[model samples]
Structure formats: structure tokens, C-alpha cells
Target: MMKEQKDNLFILVKSLSKSEKRQFKLYVGRLGVNEDSKFLMLFNILDKLSVYDESVILKKGIVKKQQLSNLKAHLYKQILISLRLNPSHKNIRIQIREQLDFATILYHKGLYKQSLKILDKAKTLAITNEEKNIAYEIVELEKVIESQYITRSLSTRADELIAQAKDLSLQNVLASKLSNLSLELYGLFLKTGYVKNDTEHKRVTQYFYDRLPEYDLHKMGFREKLWLYKAHLWYSFLTLDFIACYKYASKWVALFYENKDMIILNPVFFLKGNHYLLEALFYLRHYKKFKETLFNLEEITKEKWFPLDDNNESLAFLYINNNKFNLHFIEGDFKQGLPLIDNVLKQLEKYKNRIDEHHVMVFYYKIASMYFGAGENEKCIVFLEKIINNKSLQMRADLLSFSRILNLVAHYEAGLDYNLDVLIKSTYKFLIKMEDLYDVQKEFIKFLRGLGDIYPQEVKAAFIELHKKLKQFEHDPYQSRAFLYLDIISWLESKIENKPIDVIIRNKFESQVLKTTFN
Candidate 1:
């Protein structure tokens, strides 16, 4: 019973769209013999079901107990065939494969000339699309056909096939290596986040160089360049170098634009590249480029040619909304960003199953920041509490540390100072455990711990002292990732200048606009 609920076909069926279900039925009905067949009945039964229950199937008498697995398997195969024929699933790779399948059928029928012609066209298509693995397969089939038949360039055909196969093989191998290195580096980033100190930086730097693959830029193709840029972007992220991130992420997105079709075919990567690019811009405080990139990405997604399946749609929501928050943050328009909260939360709920925990928490952090900037200290604590109370959030130690730190600040802002000392001690111990006690965190925590000692008249002096201490680390690369979460510099300036933090940040934003105008 449990196995039935967890079956792959059941999950696939549950994930199918209404149009897919309709097409599948028409496909099954195309054969008169299948009009009332057991497998079709099983598919119909499964289609209506939210959960797969073998007992329910048994109750329907779709098939005998001994033959149930066979019927389900047959139904699964038929559904996939229907999906393959669906227009939405047709892409360059699938089109080439279909042509190859036709050629194989022709070859089996002894029509060697026809088979060779189809293979020739498919090979060109595959090569043009960077489907080199398919290109290699097509070449092998051509070679096999050529060995049995006569052709105009028989003498040079063997040489041509050998050369094409060798070239495609090398490109495929390079693409695989770069892609693997990118995946491994991504794994490391997710596991440990950015380098915390000199030791971590040295270790990650050595690890990256050790696993990095060698390839000539002049000979690299779109796929190879895409993965290569991804590898560098991950390395830049791990090193906490926003400038390098912007550089590589720009290349990543540029690679897609060079072949706009790939933006449709590889929409997930396209969305992610833009997301990372916007993040880099945000970190570097380039509000203008961030807005432009985000706007351009949204326009691209709106195009009819964009391929937006369930997965792509979920990612679109994740990336587009994330940068939307970043735009608001950089512009210091927290209240203007308010309307996005309800819509984003609703979409987050809808896409929660597709999104991972880390991303969801990242959204919460941003929303909390939005509320914090808007002077909703109580609401800010509400969002921060979600992160604070989440015991399962063990990764992203910086997130955890800052959440605790933010919680302390929010509590103080709310005049919930009765438990401030306890919260401060608890946050201090947590930071110590995470080993994230850097200059900014230490200054903030020390000030909070001694907030009781500072008289009301001397509060401005205390803020000044801590602000001066944190200013030293503003440009410190090792400690800068912290500011990416909470803009301590602007927040401190708000206190020092006796204005709301949002006002200080907004003034800075206006200054940026003025700077751009003059430039």
C-alpha cells in the first residue's frame, strides 16, 4: 500500500497538467483496441486520484492481482509517449532524436540512402544546438550506415566521421568536467556557505584550484562556457567577492543572450544567473544596474517563447521576487515594498514544496528586513522569530548568527527590554558556538550587552563608538558578507544622525542617483 503511494508513475500522473491528461486519453483512444483497455482504465483511475491506493485499483477491477504491475507499467509507458508527442515538450534535442528514430526505422528497412540523409540533418541540428552527445551518437550511426553502403565521398567519409566524432567527444568531456566541478563547488557552498576566515579561504581556494579543469577559451562552446562561468561564479560566491560575482554572472547571462533560444530551453539557469547578478549588484550597491537587470529579466520571462513549465515557473517566482526585494532594499522604500509581501507569501505557500528550506528562510529574512526598515519593530520581530525559532536551520551560520543578532535589536526596538539581557546572553553563546564572532557582530553584541550601562544622554556617544569600530571593517572582505544581510553601516548612521534607518539609507540612495546623473 505504501509502495503504491510512492510509485513513480503515480507521482508523474499527479504532476501532469489537465491538457496532458486530455492528450494522453486521446492518444490511448487512437487505437480502437485500447479504447476500453485495462491500462487506459488504470490511467483514468489514477488520473482522478489524489493518492494512489492499490486497494482502490483492486476495487475497480482494472486488472487481476497478478497482472496489476504489468498494466501499470504499460500505462506509464503510454503516458510518456503521449508526453513526448506533446507540442510543449518538443525542443531541438527531442526534434533531433525524433529524426534519428525515423532514420533508424529507415535503416532497418534497408533504405540506406534515406537513412543517411536523415542522419546528416540530425547531426547538423545536434551540433548547432550543442547537443554533442547526440551528435556523437548520430555520427556513430552514420559510420555504421556508411560501412554498409556506397556514398560519393566514400574515401574521405571515414576520415570526416572520425574527425567529427573525436572533436565532439572532446567537447562533451570538457563540458562534463566543468559542469561536475561547478556542481561540487555548489555543494561546498551550500554545506558551509562563504569562507569565514583566512583558514577557510585558503582551504576553499586550494580545493577550487585542485578540482578546476583546464580548457582553452577560444575553443569553448556555449555549453562549456556556461558551466565555466558557473564554476567561477560559485568560487566568487564562496570567496565573498561580489565584484567577481558580478563579472562571472554577467558572462553567464551574456552566454544565454548570445543564443536566445537557450534562454527558453535552459530557463532555470537563466533565472538563476540573473538572480545572482542582481545579488552581486545589491551587495556592491549598484541600484541602477540591479533595477535594469531585474526589469530585463521580467520582460524576457513574459515573452511567449519562454518555456515555463512547473519547475521554471517556481524558479521564476523565487528569483524574480527575491530581486524585487533587493530592489526595494537598495532604494530604501520599505513601505512601497509592502504590497509584495502578501503576494510573495501566497506564492511561497503555493511553491513551498518546490522550494527548499534555505530559499524559504532567505525570503523570510528579506521580508523581515523590509518590515524592520519600515519601522514595524513588532512585525520585524515576528518575522525574525520565525528564523530564530527555526532550530533546523543549521546551515548558513551567518543567517543564524544575524537572525539572533537581529532578534536582539528588534526586541530592543520594541521596548521589550525586560528580557534584553537574557536575549543578549543567549545570542552571544549562539554566535560563539557558530564561531562567527567577527568585528561587526562583536561590536553590536558588546554594545547590546552594555546597553544597560549607557545613560540616556550618553547613548549617542555609545552609538558613535560602535559605529567607529564597525567602520574599520566596512571594506574588510572577510567580514563584508555580514553587511549583506543587515546593513550595519546605514543602520548605525541612522542612530548617529538621529533619524530613522530608512531615512539614512534613502539619503544614500538619492546620493547614488545624483552621482549617476553627474556621471
Candidate 2:
């Protein structure tokens, strides 16, 4: 049996809308083919399947084992051709490529003049759209045709094409190197998360500077600038410098807005740039700017021409809702955000096939945090257990560590202490295995472990003492992330003041806002 997500044909079929399926059928029958064509029959069979079962496909007798492979390949190619012909799928890049294909055919048929005309138009369209790599190919083809067939402007044509090719090649090389560097930095962030200390920080800084290209910023084109900012954004994120991350992410999103036409052509990059920008604002506690950025993104995505295909729709839902939840956390209004939890979980199931495992786990963590802030300790434990029990999550060691620490805290809060000893021991062992024990975690676990020894009258004093100790780590770069995941300080304040946690956080935020305003 083929893995459903890994099976390209089945996934594509599953992704098609009702209208697209109807169009595919109409396209297949346009040539007056027999209804029983093997490829068409195979397509219908595969489309109807709930999963990719090869045995069931073979059992249908549509094609023999030896012929099944050929039929599948044919059906796949036909589907792509049908999609390319669809108006909804046609973009500037696709249109330029189509013209290039036609020009190649004309050249092979000895129609050199017609081919050259089409190539000229196609090359202009490609360059206008920043499709420089394809434009370079067009220039190369033009050079070959001029050399083989005499033209009226032969004296200047070769020189013009040569200059264009040289410029395009340099731009393409810059884009390629910057894109590769950006991808590597993203991989490093996913694999290990933030740099743990001075040693790790220096190591990551060295790696990033080694791969970064030297360039004149003003001379770089839009594509090159986008990749350059992306590389810098990821590097800043890995260093846990939220301010720098915001700076680069703002530049990235601004580039698209400055060239408004690029938004429609490159919707994915635009959406992602806004997502990262919102994330940085959230971490820096810029509640006003975070709200502004989020609202702007929502408006842009809802535009009439913005692409809302299934894949992008899933992404919009993910990024938009993730920040929505974050906003509630920013104001510490957990109860108000409760309405979004069920809706987000339902969409998670709907998009399970498309979203990755790591992202899904991330959702669970956010949900658990929401429940924790709402003071529903038992429910918080339930959600945290989902992250705790996930054995396959290899990336994001920070999330795993925080989940464990939060789990113990939730257990202690809910008075579910019968198994607390066993849970704390397991968490300690895992922390040692990961070597990610920050001062925050060490003190948190130590406090929880000594709960049985503290006198009832001295509990408030104990809370005050622990709160004072954790305050120092709140400013420590590496340790601050632990607090971001679980606000132990606010929880302790609530205990000492005999007030709700959300009230404590909201009051504190307002006071800080006033201080900044007056200053």
C-alpha cells in the first residue's frame, strides 16, 4: 500500500475541487475517446478510493500488473495537461512557458522568423515577471537561431542578446545562493531551535556569516532582496533576537507591498512574510503593532484577486488562527479566546493530510497554553499530554522541554499530585537527556519537588521567593523562552495576590503601556 500523503496521484486527486473534477472529465472526453479508455478508467478508480490501495486497484481488472504502471503514468500526465489548460491555473509564468514551448516547436519546423518573434515576446514577459532563469534560456535560443539563420539586424542582434544573457545569469546566481542560505538557516532553526548559550550562539553566527553573500543592497532586484531578508530573518530567529527578526520581516513584507503587482504573482511568499512579522511582534510584546499587522494581513488575504486555493486556504487558516490565539495570550484573555479552540481543532483534522506533524504538535502546545491561562488546569494537562506522548517529534526540543515543565505545573495546580512524583522524575530524566535544563526549569522542578516539605502558612512566602528567583531569568535570552511558553511568574503572582492570573497580567500590561506613554 502506498502512503496516502506520499502518493502524488492520490493526493492530487483528493485536492481537486468539484469543478476541477468536472472539467477533467469533460477534457478527457473532448477528443471523442471511448468511455472505456484504460487511463480514464484508472483515473475514475483512483479518484473514488478513500486510500491508495494497490491490491484494490489490481483487483478491478482495469489493467494487468505489467500494464498498470504505464496506465498510471499516462493518467498522471493527462491530469496535469488538463489542469494547465484550465483558466484558473494560468498565471504569467505559465503563459510565458507556454509561448516558449510553441516557439521551440516552430523552430524545429523550420519557421525561424515566426519562432524568433514569439521568443522575443516571451523573453520580455519573463523579464518583466522576474523569471530571469527562463529569460536566460530564451536568450540562449535566440543566439543559436541568429548564428544559424541570417537576420536583418545581425550586426547588433548578437551583441544585444549576449548582454542580456550576462545580466540575467548574474541575477540568477545571486537568487540561487541567497535562497539556499535561507533554506539552510530555516533547517537549523527547526532542528535545534534557539542557540542555548554563548558557545552555540557563536557557532550559529559563524555558520550564517560564512554562507552569506557579499552584495550591494541597492543594486539587488526584488527576488534577490526577498531571499536576503529571509536568510537574515531566520538567522535572527535562531538567535532568539525577536527585535532583529521583526526588522527583517518588516523589510520582506514591505518589498511586496512596494511592488504591489508582485503580491498576486507571489502570494505564498507574501503570506509567509506577514506571518513571521506577526510572530515577531507577538514575542516583543508590541500589542498595538501586532494587532495592526494582523488586521492588515487579514484584509490583504481577503482581496478579490488573492489566490484562495485549498493549499493556501489551509495556510491562511493556520497562520491567521495561530496569531489570533496569540493575541488572546498577549492580553491574557484566555476565556475570550476559548471560542476559537474548537474551530481551529476541526480545521486541523480537515487539513491533517496537508499540514506536517511538527506543526500539528505546535497547535497542541498553543491549545494547552490557552487552557492553562484560563485556569482549567485539568484540561490543560489533557492537551499537554498530547505533546508529551508524541514520540516522533524530533525537531523543536524547546517545545518538548517546555511541554514537560508545563505538564508538571498543571498537575501540581490541579491537585492531581498522587502520581506527581513519577511525573517529575520522568520530566527530569528527559531534561537530562536533552541537556536543555535552563535555570528556569531547574528552579521550577525544584520548587514543585519541595511542595510536600513547605508549611501551609509559608506557602505564600514560598511563592514570593520563587517568583523573585525566576525574575532574573526573564531577561536572560536563552532562559526567557521557557517563560514565554509558561508564564510561571504571572501564575506565582496570582497565587500570592489571591487574584485571577489573567487579571494580574492585564493590569501589568496596562501599567507598562502607561509608563511608556508618559515617558
| Highest lDDT model number | 2
Candidate 1 lDDT over residue span 368-436, tens digit each: 999999888898888888888887765577777888888888888779999899999999998888777
Off by over 4 Å in 2: 1-6, 49-59, 64-70, 153-155, 516-519
The best candidate by TM-score is: 2
RMSD of 1: 3.6
lDDT per model, in order?
Answer: 0.87, 0.89
Worst 10 residues of 1 by lDDT: 1-10
Segments of candidate 1 deviating more than 4 angstroms: 1-11, 31-77, 105-112, 150-155, 388-394, 452-458
List of clashing residue pairs for candidate 2? none
